[model samples]
Target: MSEVLGHHANEILIVSIVAVVAVGLIGLPGLFALTVPIALFGVVLLSWVAMRQHDRRLCEQCLLSMPLNPSERAVRLKRRFWMAHTGSEPRFLIPYVVVLLASNFATTTTIGRIGWAVMQLSMVYLIMSQSTHRKLQPWCPWCSEGGGGAEVDETDPVLPQDDRQLI
Candidate 1:
């Protein structure tokens, strides 16, 4: 439980830091004037990449290094869920970039602010949904090896045959 919570906390911290920095960059005077939407889009992409890398590393470590344990299962399931959700990171960002580009061409204070708010809200919702699902069902064979309380050899051969077949 602690491990799962710790991982969640770390993810939240990273996301929060990235979001703050992105917002700060967007609010800069010269920065915004030069590349308002472009800068914002870049920040989003950079942050997403950073987060994805972090997730991948965590997943690899959990899958390879850790033993089959209850807490480990939770982490694996959470990681799998995140991977599935973020599988199309580039595709997901396209619409936002398009909106940003459109906004840049003809800026409107109301629409721009609302769009930013909507993006933030969506991000928060995604994080919350993942967290909730992790809590509800933390065991998954595809994610964790301890889903059935038995550790199976994931890399073992499916069948054995006589040596003559090889010849």
Candidate 2:
């Protein structure tokens, strides 16, 4: 999992640098109209590839468990965003922050601004979706290797032995 995270970190870093450079050289007018679709498609393709590489299966139960109400969904998204930035794997926050700062510094037109906003939202959605997926993977039927259901023991202690005893 760490290896997969590292690979994604490198990919995101490269994309972040290219995005900043491209935005800095906004000499071509109306370029966002042409690039936005391609960029969005690339984001989806890369996300699919990363999921396949990580052997993640979208669990039906997990998908259904997510809140359907817009307000609840927004709250959950906000929570996940905070978790991504503050959790143990906070390294992902670096590229996200870089892109955000670059967008503010370099976006000059309304179209460019909208495109950047969409891209940022999409990236965050994908990242948070994967985080949620991985967190529930231990119980995902399809992600269980060579089994129809999860093989992991649900009663296994997540805390240290001493802490488990205290609990």
Candidate 3:
């Protein structure tokens, strides 16, 4: 998985970063309804690219799991958290993106509302499930291996031993 993702890491990172910027820009006063769909499209496109190839037959935890001891789990989770966040922001922001677009337009058709609601709920479920999986199993062997001892971001939180106990 890492080799596959690593092959396109730079390109995918750039796209996701652009999506993050677009989603952030969406709040500007002058950027209204148009920005909504554009930002939503950015997020949707990011999600599709990052996750579309995900095996539907298996959960993300299983797809991404790596076996590690307690200390290694701590080290690897801290190292890989940002990459996880990089992939997750688009997934988690769908609800806010849709609501912003809808509110900007004043109203949505019944079908549009239903669709947005469904998307929002689905993304929310996915985001929460991923977080829970990480909380339960902090180590990501693929991320640790792919990163090859990349410097840990100072801002990323390391789970304490007790916190790791929750899993």
Candidate 4:
């Protein structure tokens, strides 16, 4: 499910960014001024979808029953990183949309062009920083193979030990 959501979010971001750039390239004088704001709105939607997907994937992969014993410090740090990244999405996207909207009135001015460029750069930065960095590394073999060290009997709640019950 998260894989599907991530794919969709990326798809939206790519399409929206392309649309904004295409409008700028067409030299229509006023078209970019209008379309860029719409594209910025699309960026907000894209970011929300992507962040949700990232969280969902993290939860799915961190199952505790697998006994992989990830270090407590590492797990805590990763969780904090995820929270910070998720929290920043709205802050970046909202300003982008506002700037894009304001640019519409400036029409053929240098400010409008610069604003559009800034919006594109911001979108790229957000996607790379938030999504790529948080992606999970390779799966643990023990987790994937059902705790692959010792064979645990299906019926026993606990494993048998050398029955010496220490003195």
Candidate 5:
């Protein structure tokens, strides 16, 4: 559980830091406030569209490094991005939405806002990490492979198997 929490914390912290720096550098009038929210919304919409297709192939580094035809490549790339963005499931998005909504009603003061941010971030991280760990971790090449995962396997038998053959 600590491992899961730690990973989410690191991810959120890095993203927060980068966003803060970006906003600082660009300033409010530069459309940082406007474009980021739109982009984020677009990403969520695209992720939902991709998830509707329901492809369950592991999209970790190992699969990505394999050579694919143009059409197959496009599909795999969509699946890969969807998995990374949405944990390959719609249910996983619930906690985040709840957190964002709840945060608004929970805090008004500066200290309250700070405390709420910490509490909510921690809560969401714990929930997401535990709930999605098993499903999402397998799609991570290293975690699924006991930490010695290969980045790519050129000799993998699936490489020579044509997708049309299965169709």
Candidate 6:
């Protein structure tokens, strides 16, 4: 439970920090406020990537260093995958959206509006990429093996594979 709260706190912290910095650097422009959300989302994404990458490292280290039996390893991997799933699930996206939307509403901007626009569009790209990555993580041979999250959803987007992907 604490871990779940911790997860949210960490994400909120990242999003808030990035959003504030972007807002500060860009200066809140009420007229050009659209970009603020974009910048906030963009920085939030960068921070998310950094956090996940670190988690992946830990997963890999566990995979490589743990002396568990095959069954134990599988269990461990599933736990890790679910833990991540819990953290990254769509239900958790609400706070971020709300926060960014609120931030954008806080001020208007004129200068650097283009920069904000870029950040917003880039955030869309990042969101799409991460979405795809999330769907595919269960199937990703490397991620599953390293992050213990490689079990591909049985969904048809990716073909069924041998048990090797599970490992």
Best-fitting candidate, scored by TM-score: 4
Per-residue lDDT of 83-130 in model 6, one digit per residue for the tens?
444435568556645654555544455534544444444344444344
Cα lDDT tens digits for candidate 2, 1-167: 64454435434634654464455444334977567646745765664566454434334444555555645444445555344334324476677577766776545787666666665555655565545535544433344543643323355435655766677
- Tens-place lDDT per residue, model 3, 44-68, is 5655555434322234454455354
Two-way TM-score contest, 3 vs 5, winner: 5
lDDT (10s digit) by residue, model 4, range 1-167: 65555545654675676666556645545676776667677785865677565544434433432235444433544544343344356885577677767765664777777666666655655554444333422222322244432222134335677668773
lDDT-sorted candidate list, best first: 4, 2, 1, 6, 3, 5
Over the stretch 53-121, how does candidate 5's per-residue lDDT look in tens digits?
A: 222334343244444454454344444433444543458667756765676566566665655566444
Model 6 lDDT, full chain set: 0.48
Error of 4 at 41 (Å): 6.8
Cα misplacement distance, residue 95 of candidate 5 (Å)? 8.6
Please identify model 6 stretches exceeding 4 Å from their true place: 1-95, 111-119, 131-142, 146-151, 155-167
Candidate 1 residue 30 Cα shift, in angstroms, is 3.0
lDDT string for model 1 (1-167, tens) is: 43444444536544664564365335557755556556545655655555444443234434454444756655656655554345326786577567645644342476666555565545554655444333433354343543542222244435766789779
Q: Supply candidate 5's per-residue lDDT for 6.
A: 36
Give the better candidate number (1 or 4) by TM-score. 4
All candidates' TM-scores? Answer: 0.35, 0.29, 0.29, 0.41, 0.33, 0.27
lDDT values, one for every candidate: 0.50, 0.51, 0.47, 0.53, 0.45, 0.48
CA shift of 7, model 5, Å? 16
Best prediction by lDDT? 4
- Name the better of 3 and 4 by TM-score: 4
